[model samples]
Target: MNIDDMESLDEETRKEIEELRRITPEKHGNAFFAQAQFNLGATFIKNGNIEEALEAFSNIQHLHSPKLYAAAQYHIGEIIESNGDIESALSIWRNINHSDNPEIYAAAQSYIGFVLFEKNDIEEALLVWGNITHADAPEQYVQAQFNIGICLSEKLNKEEALLAWSNITRLDDPELYAQAQYNIGSNLLERKHVEGALLSWHNIEKKDNSEAYAKAQLRIGNTLTEQGDYQGGLLAWCNVERLDDLEAYAKAQFKIASFLISFEYKQAAIKELQLIELMDDAEAYAKAQFNIGILLGKNSDIKGAVKAFRNIKYEYDSSAYGNAQYRIARILISNNDLTDYTSAKTCFELAREVFSYEARSYIRILELLEVPETKSFGLSLLDLLNIVLDIVDILTLNFSKYADEEKPFERKLAHYTSTYTSNLLLGNDKNNTRPSSFRLNTINNVNDPSEGQLLIRKLKDVKDNSFVPLAFDKKFHAFISCFTFNHDSLNQFRLYGKQDNKEASGMSLVFKKDFFQSKNLIGGISYLSIDNTLKITEAISNINVKESHDIQGQKIKNENDDQELVRRSVMRCVYLDPTSDYFHLAQRNRLTFFREFGDNIVIKNGTKQSQAEYEWGVYQEYIKIITEKFEVAYQILKTTYKEVETEINNVRFTLGSLKQKELAILVDEILLPLKYLIKHSAFREEQECRMIYITSIDRPEVTMEYGSFLYVEYEPSVKDHLDKIYIAPAALQHKRYFDNILKNVDVPVEVSGNVFR
Candidate 1:
């Protein structure tokens, strides 16, 4: 109630009470009169008339001893404490020794202890608080136990402090319990028992005290960061829910920004710092603006960075304002623009004026920045800011530097230019040179005919050699440059040879024994290398337009035995159909060639056939190279087959008959040559003996003839006639389907044992 309201009521009540005290009949009852006086004291106390209440209660003590007297004394002590007379309050409470009023006695003793604690008398406070053992005063007992822990912890008696906190067994008083636990955690953290400390903090219930809970979460993040688990620390900080404490929240956000900057996430760091500006905290807002200026300058947003620095008001944070001005000067000086030098000098002078006491120290550091030896210590931007913030009081920097804080981030330049200082740079160190590889030019030179002759002689005359299995060919011998062998059950292998020199780097070939026609072999080959030298007058695509004219030019060059012509290998595609006479004469021809003295097979043989698509697609590629204008050596392949010509049809037939069904009808016409040569070999051991026969001449009736064959039929009007057909394996279906599950439920099938075994 207002003082006027209480005075108005007190004046009328006082006159009536005085008249009743003077005119009351003493014979009727003095007991009734005493009760009426005691009630009057309570009314005075409620009206905030402390002196009058004391007088009324003191008069009752003379006439009679009642519970009202004890209540009045308790309130009198409270009024003295509220009025700032703590000593007087303590004395009054200490004299209230009424044994009959256990509640008042217990509360007065607790109040005396609290006052002693406020006065910094730790030993006396602890003793007085420990004396409150009233069973009816659970709240007082809990508060006393908590305060005792705080006193002991402050004195560095950690064990004793924790024991005192543990004595508070009251679960109903959540605020006191949480406070005690928080104190215990703080003590444990001081002792370097990090895990135990975090456990104790995590035990605090957030539902009880939200401010304390937020603090615990922030501490967890700081502790993790000190331990060098940076990512883990960030996760803990992110979980800190905003509470009543704006200062703690700002601190948490600032810490998050520092961590992000250290990890090179500069943009994210800037955003985290900017969050502080939304809060009402002037100090946090100024610090955030200073950091934002540094980050903007790093990003090369020069004007934006200057504006951010200039926006830092001196009244909010004098240190931040001074530091921002210093940065503005540093940026302007580094910019080296003639127009900005005058402004830069002005900024530096203003900064000095703001920090006059430390002005010389800053200037000395700036001079040291010019010395290469002192400047190249490689301190990061954040580190420089931290050192400046230190020894400056405007910034309340409380966190102590731990071991991880000692490590600074790597320095980095703002721009990637050659004419920059070596003060800061960021990137992993790597060697400029490429990885080392074995040199092979000296012994494997194609120009030396003696080397070629030696390789052929060794391959034909090796006596004690068993054919090394293909699977065991991963390792190679230096002497034997190239070798090949066929699988035992599959005779679809050919051994090709080549001089392993730089000249043969781009040339490739492929061969496969025809599975359908066991007595015949069909294959294709082409050369797709470009001969582009500065000497050539015409563009590469226009080099060999007329087939015969190009062939003649190549022949003339070969006849002259030019160095370039000597290294060029023959590019040809030789196929033997069953109806052709060469199929039966191949074996006899081979014997005759070997019988008539030794054959120079080294000139014809090359690397073993690994990818059939390379050789089979060469014809289609030759057509593509000239038609689509791909650069290739003009002398390699003279013929440029038209799309509808017989040569392209033949090439398509050979590739479509392979076991691979996906490439049956190559979709992209432009990919005929380049795509074919670049495809990885789909060769596997199980597929070695398999082959397919495809025909597009006519749509025939489907029929199965062999034990492992399946025939398919296509109507005449079918748009996508799939011509490739391979025989199915025993006990297997070629059709594909997905297993359906009802109600969109997933069913797992567990398969046991290895299939291969």
Candidate 2:
């Protein structure tokens, strides 16, 4: 009876046969004979000697020993089935005596159910499996229960199915038990009993059935997620990694990778997705490739991103291919390399079919930023910047010359500067001097940090999905000059800066408003309160922008009311040549699709580019920089027109579906003058009127004052437009010298002496 230590079935069976032989048939009345036959048959089956096993089992008879006889009969059926006689095996199993040997009888019934189910006899199989119980045979009983659950689940009897599956225990049959638990959880989830479903899945015994165990973990993760317990779901999914089931493991890893992104664990998330690429599931593998490519691009791993994108099969996922191609082109251009532009162009051509409008936008941008060695393709906005600044300074505030009789046509403005710099404006030099020109400083060097950009930061309502970064890559250029006119007294002059010495004496150059108005310059400053809260509705993308928090009790001006804001500025002055039906955006205003750190354009990392994380400032950079720009270039370059007008000779344009507010946000973000014009409320008392000159500063005639700052000198006729120049209190000491300097002039040069000093 202690045969547990036996090394082989042959040895154990031989010892049993010898002992049974010793109990002669005369003493045991043929019962020992039946027992010896059963042991021989079992040893034959173990050795895979089917014919010998059949012969041995057939010798056992129910009259001699009923239990041994029924067991031998069951062994014969197994041999018949293994030998391919399914009908014979089922016939033999069906005739087993249940009363004499319940274990063998249960096994026979279990086989019958399997054969019927395999033959599509669902009703017959369910009936057979439903009759089995633990009282008959524990192992066979659990197998029957598991099958019954599956059959009932398919038959729409969910409650019955759950009951059948729940009755099975790991102690009876671990593999079957695990599968049964998985089915119970799945059925419960289908019935919308989420908590019960998750509980069952979580309780799955992983014994040797890793497939079912892995599946259970996946279900638990999903169930928790559906209940809004994302952390719980992620943790559950993470548990699947312990198993060897490739499909389940890949699915869990994908979910975990995506979750890690929200927490900014980029490298860890990328590592997870990378593992999924080698896993068994085709769908998860493809998605992992795409997301990995995206994450790599964001992390600035260009080579790795490109390789990941290229690994995706176009036949597997064409949509992902197109999107990936579009990004590949962008990453190539983001490096600002001309050699990469060719490859980028090829990628765009491939992507154009899918991203018709967006791909075309970037293609046009490449043309504008084409290598200078080739035919020039830059936004020659130095002239345009100068022209738009004049247009805005001279004509903008007039609102098309408001025709209101009550409004004064004649206005006066003032320009405050140091006495030493003042002399340069009155000098005789042509381009270098200003009776001929006035100086324009770069917008960045201005006192207000918000110069050239004020609208985007304060905007609240934006459809981030529509965002496109302006494709124009060359350094966006804006030059600005500040002035205060409404209050041009000594106090105003002093507010500009302190008088360093005699040369730095702050002089307020009072001029007739008619002179500037005649010269196409305006006289008004729009001071905005940046201190007021900006209603942030859209997520700022990759473009660098300062971050601010939301708190109560702060005045919210642009609180979802986005329509009133204006987007047009000198930065994007569209020369709508209606005749050609083609025009370019104001390239000189130094505007961008979205900008950060003053120079880093974030178009490559826009939402449209499929960047999932939100740690950027450019809320919307969706620059269809179209007919106002690159669309014109797209039509010119494609030359793929049929009878329509997209031929190389003709011009075609693209205008994206931009809502007024969204478009305003996109354009306002890059408009260079708004950054200068919209000063903070803190400086409201200065009554400032800024003159912004947006242009190419790459080769500017910029003068550095006393080794302090750089400024571009422009020649404006200040003498002709002169009203009267006011002498500051410090300059009053040199009144006679000032009078002698302007003795030939008819205009007054008065002094405002501060008696308090």
Candidate 3:
């Protein structure tokens, strides 16, 4: 009967249980009764009532059914194990092994082995497992073999354990075969037989269609990396061709990239990283990009590197974001290009808000870049003003809107006024240059608006003596002008203001004092500022004069005259022009000024009578002065310029520094077309000559040093100027200039004729 129609008896469920037991023997026979008791015991075991389950299982011994009795015994072992009775559990499991049913026998054997393993009787566990060697044994028997392998491996008997696991591959079950192969590889790995382990793991892929193969591939790759075979490891990882498992694939790719970097194959690492298919995972992609940036930065590609680093979001991972921000700022500092200074400053400020580790260094970088310290200081002032303004604006707006409800407004005003007074009192530092504390007090609502406004007005009226003049000196002007003109000519100069607005733009030049002293040079342009009138102004007033004037005393006249020339060198000088195009005018003026003082002009020896000997000496001397005046500054600038050029050249270097196989790939894929294009151009003949020179240099072993190991004798048809010259060891002598030519020329050349062909 349904429960609703059940008898009105107070113990309905109890009566039902008794009725079920009464009919069970007749309805299901003795075997069914035993099975029913076992099932009820299993329910108790599932419900965590182990004692009740054991009591129910004990009743099966009274039943006359062999299969049911075996099941009950097996369940009793499980219940005893759950209750932490190891000896009793083992006894119950061993009893099941004597049962006549094959399935029950296999199950019992597995449980007995597990019990022995837990008891630390590994040998006995293996002995129990070894009894299940029949070919027709259930999959549980194969699983037992795998377990024995694990125990043997733990005992350090890896080889024999691997053999035991290998026998599992003969099982027809695909899952069992995969597990066995994996176990064998694991054992081999413990013994440091990396290749053997990899081979066994690879067999899993061949035998299994499950994720077991993917896991095996990852293990094999890790093993190869541990053994220092990075390339092999990467190749093994690439064997996981499962595009559906993009996360795993991306992880493998990242590992490969990290491995390549460790081996100093950065370009290869970047290439491998780019091949990862999962670009959607922002964290992984950002990490990969960040690593690429670091690699580029280490290799001196600062700008590209900074861009990569700066692309990471602040929200990704705070630590990683902070690190990327720090790197970006550092690269900006090293850039020497002031174009990014403002942005760098902003980035640093943002970084300060989230992380302070890089804040001070960023501040120092800004200081070096000459960003007005007042800019940051101004922010404090503005913050103070904003706070007062916000309070006043809110109070006024709310009061006007809700005059009828004046209580809340009046209370807010009282609170704001109190805060303002407290801040103002604390901010009262009369002697400091920056009213920073005062400003912070206002922003923190520690000062009244009127007092803060008065203080700000006084600060503004104080001449902002905060705006320090650029340190203009005679040497500074000369260096600045020269640096501006030369760097601009090289297409490397970037001014501070509008590109076409020359008057708004300012130029800076730096020098090192040690360089000047070493080179015996003086005078360089340091800084140049153009006013609205377009007049070029110098930062320094006094020009340096040479201590010794002996060199200044002597001079030579034009070619046809032997007259002693008058020395017209000026110790200090300034050239100024008010023209709109002052840079062009300044250039012309400088040319005239040096012409008037011929001794100051650099001279180079050439066919032209006006050509001077060693003009580089004068240029080097000019560079020396600037180097001296601003040693650290100029060095930083020089390094940055060099870095930029290096970055541009790095792409070429990547292909250029290739090994044999890599070089072959590049030549076949890239160089051949380049050669073909050059062959069809006007440079063909020149290219042919260059190609010959390159070929000759390429085989360096065949070309000995011209002077040290080999000698050349030349008898010119018109060398009458050299026929009688003595080859003196201590005086003027006629010596071949081959070494000099080689030292000066960038590209290799041969003297086919009087001309360098």
Candidate 4:
């Protein structure tokens, strides 16, 4: 039978081998015996019996086919390499001298250069590829030239790189040629030849069907964006969406979303980011979720931010996964109103999987891990992680490259109230009306009728006035206390005494600004900043967040202070200006609060990290063996006139990333209560920063006032908090009375008698 017919039947090849053995050497001769042995080896290889295959290949005598004898050695090298013994593999390839099989000789050289290049021995790799020519192994020769181009580029020989890359033809290797075009375009772009770069990148898609085509489009979009042609850039990016390359598609989408954000279309940007969710790429999805979380956090939508971060899968990208973990932990710790140490500890532990902290962090963790089991012998450093993991944090790891210590500066805030209220505040022996401490009133009951009920009014208009009953019908109002961050503004004295035209000249109660931050109430202060006072909310806005991400821990001890942190989510600085773009978003958020987020909280399964690809397990060894069998078979047949092909479809495997989605569930639940922070733009002039505490209506902390309005007694850290008292400018006559009232106070007393006027 013909070898072509025999090639398809391994069983026939085995039968032929047995028949050849039965016949004498003189009957069929060395030709038929050698052919049968070679066919048996290929059969053994296909069956994944490497030992038997190697034995059969060894039976091929050099007297019959020297190329086949040489090809067998090449097969052994592949086996060695697949087993991770690259040294032996390289040695075997180096000795494969076969002038009879020029294709195999050049193909082996191609692999040798590839291994060298991957190991970063660029010069030697280039030297090996330089020996290849178009006459020998035509396809391998083109691939060799591709590697030479990379080598030349790495050595800064831009001119030589272009010349080497120019040698690749679209017909010979379109993928490599497309890559060359990308490199050439990049080089031209760097040289300021904008037209040349565009022309070069434009031809990539004409001949390329691989990821290189999408990459070229991505580059084109970047170039257009850089040249100030935003519409052209956006159009180019939009074209990359359906290019069958998820990573490049993700890059383009991110740019488009960034453009939307820069143009003050944040909601549109959010919708664009959400588009990444429909793609099948895990890394791209993780990246999109991370950015959305950050944007949400910046917008003071803490719930949405947490949900976005939790959506990242650990299996996608280690850095992104680590960042997601660290960010979640930071959010939990910063949101200390709930005092969720247990949850924070779990998040910190997950973050530890990807982040490697400095010596100081390990030392800090070690210091805290002082249990007897953890305090063992000299091998403590190795076992330290095992112990420290039980109690996570002090991992003040920010969004930056490394965790850093915080820097703090002290300051004070002045709260002006009626002299009678101040007298009652200081717990002086007043009438029966004096509370145990200062009172934070419910929003509806606040004196400012126009500004105080702004949030409730806005909510009543959204979803066709739907959320009002769900939020307010149950009397679930947020209690509030307003504070202005002015150090010593003259207008404060003028503004406070005449609230609603009430002639109530009050003394300013100066308290240490750290009092609120210490309690982690997050009062209009960025959760990112745990230490800084309210001096530069406007200035800090200009400073790069990475540079100013220093926070010192000053946790409030319950027994050490009478004040307690109630149910608070976030404290955003009052956004000023009615015409500002952010004000529009804030306004929209209030109106659509009920519509975007339904009456009940939602926990999405989609928010958890995506699963990871599984290891090539059962067929790991077989995959290597069978793949090498084909390599050897190709080499032995390269010099022959006949051609044969073999193929085996690969199976895919996966393992999913796992973590708690409590953070995602909390996002919808928290947004409703935190909605009270935004107010009507009319209150822009007051520049008031209010703290919103969403407590249940039945809590005993609610104190009834005037037999109708409700107030909560919040004993803020007031003992050392009173910095100084300034009697209102109009109340100069009562300055002596204020002094007598604050006689026990060690702070300075001043008269604000028409100082500005």
Candidate 5:
């Protein structure tokens, strides 16, 4: 039968072997009989008939040939060992009478050492192999020498181990030569002679496709890589020619891919990694998949990269598996079209949990972590409002001092009545009433006199129709209020108030010549000095806030005897109550009050007439406030304040300037009730964005449409990466409206001292 046909037909091959065995001459010391019997034993073992093979080898004692019997004993030992009977096989090999056959005796001795080495008796194994004299059996002698070196290396006797391996001069068999050279290289590496090791590894000629040759080639690449010659190492790994060891071949390919990736040959590296699946090594294949993902990602094939990483399977705490998960997250993030930010969030979370802190993925994930913003570039509308509200709170707290010290509207009305009655009874002017109301106006110049004139005209109309007290005149109020803090309040105020209440009654207006330059009023007292008194009042108010627990306390504290009564009196006059008639009067006359002063006070050096020469000075201090400062604040109210209001209820604000629609938007959609928000949220820029994060959820919209759910927007953007993009001030429409309203607006001031009532 043909060899191929015989290999496929095992029964026929066994029958032929049995026939040969039966027909062999039974004469003792007959070479043909011994050869036929040995062949039969080998065929039986090949057929997996270990019992028959063992019986055949044991019958070799009748051959009457020491060499054949010894060989047969060695075969019996191999069969027994193959059957996992290690001790029995060891005993059989040890008892083999190979004294007359040097080759067989040497092989038997080497087998004893091999079994001992496997059993972890390294010292005895070394002694057994070392006892073999290399006088005959070159094959066995070479093997014994190699084994001795391995044992010595295991014993850590580097010098003696190298000497033992180097003793092999004959190199007829390529496997033996490669094995010896490979051992020498290992010992050299152990001794730290990397270059010598490389040289020894390079000389391991693979004349046959042996495992040793494959290992030597792999080691050469490893040594070169250790020496920082990655390019050369990769080339050596690529040159690995081995069919006997698939694992080693896969490892070599993986190394080559890694090296190519280091050099940025991503496409080539990906191809090399892709070939690892052919090796069928689960661990190597997983590692290769991870590396291929990295390569594909580096090449900008994001989808391909994600697929590659997702393919890695569970393996014993596999670093590659963890790494693959991490890469998948990176691929998703880098895609940057996060239609659904939460979709990839789990991937990121899983990657972080799977990888250890020391893993490259873990470190990268940390670097990508979004830290909550403490500050921002531009304030959102709501954020700006919060700041304005905070400023208002501070100002209100300061104004509260006047509220406590000054007479209330009812008391002031009685005092004026008594004075009027006394004067009338004493035959004084019957129509005369002590200054019933007082005006505290902040004078600022307009850019165009016509603009100021326009404002004055508009103010008359507003004053006539409006009923709400204490018109804010955000433009002028911000300008003058800023000075109280030693800060330009105009630039800080973005709020606008508009009120209409017919029942509101009290109104007062007073004007004096040269108020801006002289800083002195009709009473020959310096307004500057009076302004100082107001500043002191504001300072005292701020100090009171810090010292007191409640800003708006129900019970008022009595003034100290040593306190400056005059300063308190003056500050009380400056207090424009939001609900009082005086406040209404001021709002009505606000535009006219502002027009009284020019935008700049031009003081020429040669001018000696101080009063007439000095005009309005440029109000650069508060110019920023009116132009666009409050735009963001307005937008905050306009956009999301209503939605915020429903979730919170601690603090409530009464905004004056907003229209009915704007007010509805605030209550219905934008503003949050203060209960759920931080107390000083308005003062904090971060709170603006934080609110968006809280309320602006991108829930996937589903509707009954055919079978699939329909979404209005696919893949909403992530909030973290988008913070900078949302940074914007109030809307342009609001600013334009304010500009138009302020340009021609005028406030009316009344200089009347008597009350008709």
Candidate 6:
């Protein structure tokens, strides 16, 4: 049977017939067997029995002969083409086209063109179809030309489309010729040749009873629209709608909306969009809602805009939903007249939940509302003012619970106040009060705790607009004592000395200076000089007999020793002068001492002897005489000896003399001790002797004139004796005794200050 006969079978019956053909034996030789099978497969293909037809062709391949194989392959290609397996069909056709069988080769070439045309390979398809130059070429070749024209027209190759279609127009089939004319109209429309498009489309006979006539009318209208004729465009779209296609209607509504929007008639555009909304397409509804929201927002009807935006669901319109929520929150914040903080907060919260990644601006809005000033605004406007207050109280209480944790309520309060103040300043609202400067003094009077109860009481009376004062009752003197000591040693020196040694010691002396009256030394001595000569004789005899003997022996046995002692004694006078003019005289004495000594009497003894005998005795005795005499003379001349003695003790007179401008006195008086003990409970070595001189030169004319004399002598035989003679001033002698004992005990110095206590 031929393909035309196979087309008459029902699809199921044709499949069964092809299946029977595959299993049944051939009635003739190989050539006839192949031919019969090929015919059977063609019939299956025409009836859409592709699977069964493939099986029939597989049986033909078993012959193994090239001529038979080529014929079988050609049949397979035709079946594959009918089945719409274009790639597989092309492969099979290529194999047959190379075969030696002329009939098989021609059939393969014709089928190849059909497959290529199906793939939209118009050029290759037309090339293959053109090889069939004979008038008797198969009907499949005629179909290939028509398909090529459709492909060319779709790609806007107008000339090529016309040529392919014109070739098919020569066919005898009236249906095929109508299709070619319709495709030529499409090609001219794509090229924007409106006159040619109308001509080609009008060439199709509407009476032919095909879909081509309706399509041609649509094309002609669309061509007019492409030339900037919107009325014509709508008419073409109306033609498609008249055909009762829902997709075309929806598309037409969308196109009208887009066109209106492009023309800057947004309101008119929205009306067209409403048509799409009525159509119930969810995507279109979402877009229409967003556009309406934008239009309303632009018109500043923010509430209406927000309602429109919120109409969109989150899933279908997340971006628009988030944007709409943000807009509502921002508008509410800016309006301020609404003052509905609750609604504002809700809007922002919903915005953050829906679009967490882009919610920072919305979050800032909520934060600003929570500030005390804005919250006050909400309290004023909100009908549920009590509930708002209750919530704030609860938050404040909860916030205080973590006040001592990582984030403190005090710090947060400070931060909030600052933020509120900054925002108020930025808004430049005159109703908002500027933040006041912090008044720390209101909290505590004295900057530190060292102030006494007097300051504390003052602090208690002081109050500020913010913060309460704290009163501290107990004295802070105890704390002060932690860093300070009574300094009993320093106090003793202050009280007993004729002139507070602090003044003489280069420290500020705080004493009632008026209590001790100054007096002329000459007048005092004159008043008490009924026995001045006797007093001098007594002072000279008071020098130790042994010390006097040693002095004489040192002077007679060594001229150098004698001269050095004289030089040092004279040099001591320089320190006595407040003006220090005697320094030149002292230097001359020093040179005389060095020249006379000249390495004799052992140079080592010079320093030791000067420090011990001469420095401590004559030098110190001269200073002591001056100090004592001055005190005594002052008392005798001013008050009386008994009255002065009551105020001061340990005074003795040494020498006195008169100068041109002033009367000078050398006196013996006890000064602070310069004594230290051997440490570690260890006695000083027998060869080590410690000596201290408790006297100084006193010159009222100059400050810092009085100083203690100290000397240490190391001599095994006289070491103990040296200690006894090295008495300290009556004021600080005990301190020296304790310091010596403690040092000998090897107690650490850190504990020395507390040792006596």
* Candidate maximizing TM-score: 2
After superposition, the stretches of candidate 1 with alpha carbons farther than 4 Å from their true spots are 1-7, 10-38, 62-67, 80-88, 134-136, 168-172, 228-232, 241-243, 278-280, 313-319, 337-757
Q: Write the per-residue lDDT of candidate 5 for residues 1-757, one digit (tens) a residue.
A: 3334445446778578757666445553366677677777787777666676677677666345678788898888887788799999889888766475778778888888878877889888888888677775777777777777766665667788788778765354466666667767866775567888888778766664356666777788877875667678777787765474576677787777766765678888888878877345667777777667767777777777778877886562244555566556544444565322343455545544332211222232233233222111011322423443432222111111111122111111001111122122222122342321111212222111221122222212232322223332221121111111101011111121111221112111111111111111111111122111111111100111000001111112322323422221111111212222221100011222133333534335664433212321222222233223333433343343333333222122322323323433333221221211211212221111001001111222212245532212112111101101100022222333223322322212222222221
**Tens digits of per-residue lDDT for model 1, 1-757:** 2335455465777675565455332654545555566676677777667776666655554234445455556777787789898878777677666464667777887888877776778899899888777384777777777777766765767788898777765374776666666667766776667898788678777776666666676777888886877787788677665554565577677778878876789999999988875454566677777778879988988888888888887787655666677778767655655225456556666665333323333344344345453332111211332232321111111122322333211100000101011001111123232222111111122222222122112212332222222221111111111101111111111111112221111111111211011110111111111111111111100101010001011111221223211110111111112121121100011222222224332211464332323222332343343323212221112122121123224434554535123321221111122211111112211111111112121223223345622333211111011111111111012111101111111212111111211
Candidate 5 to truth, TM: 0.40
Q: Which digits, one per residue and each the tens of the lDDT, describe model 2 over residues 1-757?
A: 2334344456666676457446545677778878777776777667665676788789877888888888888888888888889999989888787887888888888888988887889899888877677998898888788778777776778789889889988788777777777677766765557778778777775664777777777777766764667788888888886345777888788778876875689999989888875446655676678778878878877788889878776675454566668778867765654248778888877766444434544565466457442112122211222232333342232212222222222245567777666565555333343343566665555554434333233222121222233232124445555555332354555655236643325677776643432221111111111112121111111111111111111112332234322111111222222123333332111121121123332235243332221112222132232222344333322222111111111221222324223433322322333344444444554555555444343443445567645566543356655677777766666556555555544557776533324
- Model 3 residue 483 CA deviation in Å: 50
Off by over 4 Å in 6: 1-75, 78-91, 95-230, 242-247, 257-272, 277-286, 289-757
Please report, in order, the local distance difference test score of every candidate based on alpha carbons: 0.42, 0.55, 0.42, 0.53, 0.43, 0.38
Q: Provide the lowest-lDDT 10-residue window in model 3.
A: 686-695
What TM-score does model 4 achieve against the real structure?
0.40
Best by lDDT: 2
The segments of candidate 4 whose C-alpha lies over 4 angstroms from its true place after superposition are 1-11, 19-37, 49-52, 55-73, 79-92, 115-121, 187-194, 278-757
* Residue-level lDDT tens digits of model 3 in 474-582: 2111110011122111111122211233321211111111111111110110011111111111111111111100111111132213321111111111121111111
- What's the candidate order when arranged by decreasing lDDT? 2, 4, 5, 1, 3, 6
Write down the TM-score of every candidate: 0.44, 0.45, 0.36, 0.40, 0.40, 0.31
Q: For residues 670-698, write the lDDT of model 4, one tens digit per residue.
A: 22332454555555544455544545566
Output the better candidate (2/5) by TM-score.
2
Clashes of 6: 13
Question: Model 2, stretches more than 4 Å misplaced?
Answer: 1-28, 205-213, 263-268, 275-283, 313-757
Answer with 3 or 6, whichever has the higher lDDT.
3
The deviation in Å at residue 532 for candidate 3 is 59
